[model samples]
Target: MDRTESKHVFVIGLDDFNLAELQTVRNADEYEFHGLVDYDTMVHPPSYPMDAILAEARETLANAPAVDAIIGHWDFPTTSMLPILRREWGLPTPSLESVLYCENKYWNRLAGQEAVPECTPAFQGLDPYSDDPVGDLNMAYPFWLKPSVAFSSYLGFRIDDEQQYLQAMATIRDNIHVFAEPFDNILQYSANRAALPDHGSGATCIAEGLISGRLCTLEGYVHKGEVVVYAIVDSLRASNNVSFFSYQYPSHLPVGVRNRMISYADTILRHIGMDQSPFNMEFFWDEATDRLWLLEINPRISKSHCPIFQIATGASHHEVAIDIALGRKPNFPRNEGRFPIAGKFMPRVFGDTVVTRVPSREGIETLQKQHPELVVHVAVNEGDRLSTLRAQDSYSYEIADIFIGADSESALHDKFRHIMEVLDFRFSDVVPTNYN
Candidate 1:
């Protein structure tokens, strides 16, 4: 195809430069890719300038060639940025209100109640900044508390007592507005802007009665109002089961269970009217009660699961996001890829600690040479404090992300265990004065 005939897609927050895995959909010969804005400036604290980001994106898109689609995998600002850019460029995208309906935890809960009340949990929105934060709760203790619009589980905590509630509330009160302010900026462009609450003010939090069961994600897209689900990945947690340890594709859940979850997601999407967008819905299936609880829904692909899908499904789900944005059906392979199963594992340390040793480039290269298929991404470096890392959950520090493929789940676990032993990260056993 000639260059003029090529379709160009601009990713709002292309955090990393690596597009090797995603290019499986099409190389430069078929489509041109453009990246605008860094992830840090858009999602982090002290610099979430939503208006500036939007202005900069407009400038980039105007200068670039005719753009065909806009896509993103990260949450908050990136997913939030897509609709605005799509509107400016006249590309296919869900309405800003539809995207907000999915990203705002509190609003999502409200919609879920009407759409799939059976799957929606008991939830209430609270103002953590109030003197009586606990008094605002319609639900009891032992519930999860998180910002209405935050990413990567940052500032998310489990509220079990008055002290824990107070502590989590303090952190939330101080930081919730980091994402909230920028989030509120995007709402102004929404058609249903008047119907929403002030979630971008850092005062609101969602407290829900804890729901327990096997957790999995339903990944799919809605195109021209039709919702189609393609994959389910089982989320395996470590330690107390509150923090994620690994994500395994080709979930062990029965076909019937998977279909039911998909059906439930389809109903919810239809109700919310999320059209021309890729989405991932997290759910918990309580085997004892045989019930499925809708945890949350994001208006983008789960970037964490992309590589595993590429390893097991022969293509990255990026294909779906891009194709749907370009007004085409995803042409993923029906046959499985190189691995029957694959896992993305987060090697986590439970307490605050200082890194004493990290795998050298030489060590990582050696391991890759020994096992050509293994992928190692070290998040921490020597002399760095684990607590200072960005986007960590409250309970633990993830030192690295490791991806591997195996013939079976057990084999995948075994390979991950061996890989951890090989990397051999050493940490100083020190207690932090500000431990959450």
Candidate 2:
């Protein structure tokens, strides 16, 4: 609770939005955050230059005033590079190998099966480029297929038959390199690469048996071998059950279900050797059979849910990561906000289209004035085409992200619907033209 000087910390893929959230954490005045690299260089670029990015970061750090801590919140190469940077700076953080275990979906499922087979779904790895990609999978149809290293379900798909498998693999074979090449760059750094499956690589895919029901994420940190989880946020999905619909804090899942999730998460993280780091683990609860399934684990704070946490917990969950990066145990308070519930809503459209108009900045600001808890981030502008957007999930194009606080779930939905209606986004569908 006392400090004589500021601690300079560096954030991978830092942006103005999250920077504002980071500043609201405890002891904000005592911390100075330097953007290790801008957000667009990592997310907006057509391809990642992993080696060049690393070299630039190292050179920049070499010239900084101080490097007390390093942390990241985005998916790879941010997650993959955070451990690498921390190790370079001699700061307290998880080993890169442990992070790789979580980043590689194939390896992550393998570790989960060993630690919690009861909750682990059946999964098989496949090299998308192999001559017989579908034959490599031993599982039946109606499975989820995805690139091992992609985020936001960029290339993920559901396979119902052999025909669909081939179609998806064709797409993966063509576009997987956008993420894979950069990810392969990460794999070369692993001293224990041999210990993992040699057949495993970023270009590969994982086909997993379907698991469904209530979805939620447990967010916390492991400090000195102790894995502590402080929040379980519910993940509401679109009717299609693919893209995320919204995230609500202080999940309404049963207390018993929540405890089981925490127990399984602790066992798996310990087994994966994840210590001295922040992580968020996802899970699904099948209310029909009262069965629980492990979805995936991320070795960073949830960047999307950070804002909602600010309203629900009175501060962004980034506080947990900042404290951990500083080698201090997380002391994030819970349920201390003005509202009873808070959420982040992701509204999307299904087809390729061009944006015609977006809500005016002044109009959004006027709404924010009335509802201080509300924040709208418009992703596209006038005349922007949806298909060209990078890192979007296969099914839909997310046009904007809405964050708000409400007293109940019904209230949350009403608030979000009304907000979107007021924002009044206009779009024109793109028509396909036959090529001769």
Candidate 3:
């Protein structure tokens, strides 16, 4: 842990906020972190520019004194690109095929069905560009349709009828390339990717039987041959059940259900050959039927939950990712922090609107001072036009994110309400959304 012997780590799409998190990691002085690619350009950009990002990262790697680890917290192309970079450099990380098992929805479902059929949903792949996509699909109305390789619920839709299915397909065809092109680029790197189903490419979509219940996520990582799950977060949704409302740490689910999720996570991670990597797997427990369903598996830390984990635990889960990336065992913390509860609230305005007003930097600073355990990140500026919000779900636009820690759940919500009321946000030219 000497300063002179500190190792160098490269992070894809690194930003100021995450850099601050990395600094608080245990033994922070033992590593020197470098940003591999521009955050804005890498995430929700007009184009992925995969080649450009790889070339830029290579240039940085070549200049570094020594590369100890390569880590990233964002979704694809960050998650998809991690294995490729690590494999090329002989770094310790999951294989490309294993990472793809978690990224490709169809492939992940196949693995889930094999490993834990009880928790896996019935699904089938459908080529959105096919002459008879619906004809090939067997699911009835009220099923879910989405890209095989998507993030943040982009292009995800619940099909209640034929008209809705057609509309969703048209929209998918239009925007699918934004993710498909770059995702395919990474797919090509997989040695056995050709063996996958023809319709399992990034451009494809999956039809899933309607599965709903208590939504929760287990954040964990695999190292060497062992799988470890550290925390479970409950995902709350708005009334529409389309957009996420907030992510609260320390799930309130029954102990038995949480254990099944953990056991399934371990099974799936081992079956998919995931190792030396971090993952956050989501699950749904159907209370009515006393059934459990595997939602989706992501092959990396959920950056959205990092702050909440930090508030509930003493350190951020980034430490687990960093450690695993370095080919070392993770020294992660459990419920050892100040607060018994923490939550991340995503305040969304479900339409396109021009930003007329937002809280000033001074005002935010004052609020933070008043509430020590509070953190607010406003996503828009005063004069900014809200033409497109690519990082959000298809149904709504998340204008700001608020993270807070409190002794009780009610207090956590109380803080969020006070912040929303005090920090006024005004918009113009609003297009009201109808989540029907």
On lDDT, the candidate that comes out on top is: 2
- TM-score of each candidate structure, all chains considered together: 0.94, 0.96, 0.95
- What does candidate 3 score on TM? 0.95
Give me the runs in candidate 3 sitting further than 4 Å from their true place.
193-199, 334-336, 383-387, 429-436
- The true-structure Cα RMSD of candidate 2 reads 3.7
> Lowest lDDT 10-mer window, candidate 1?
427-436
Across 1-436, the per-residue lDDT of candidate 1 in tens digits comes to 7888888878766655336656866444688877777656655547587787888888888888788888887788788788888887888888887888877888888889898999888988888778887677677778899998887888999989888988988989888878778777777777676655444343468888889899999888888888888888999987677778899988899888889999999898888778999899999999998999999999998888877877787677888888889888776545657888987898888887889999888998998887676778899889998778888888888888887889998889888888888887887885422111
Model 2: colliding residue pairs? none
lDDT of 2 by residue, 60-107 (tens): 799998899888898888888988888888899788889988888998
Cα deviation of 13, candidate 2, in Å: 1.4
Q: What clash count goes with each model?
A: 0, 0, 0
Across 390-424, the per-residue lDDT of candidate 3 in tens digits comes to: 56777788888898888888888888888888887
By the lDDT metric, which is better: model 2 or model 3? Answer: 2
User: Sorted by lDDT, highest first, which candidate order results?
Assistant: 2, 3, 1
Model 3 clash pairs? none
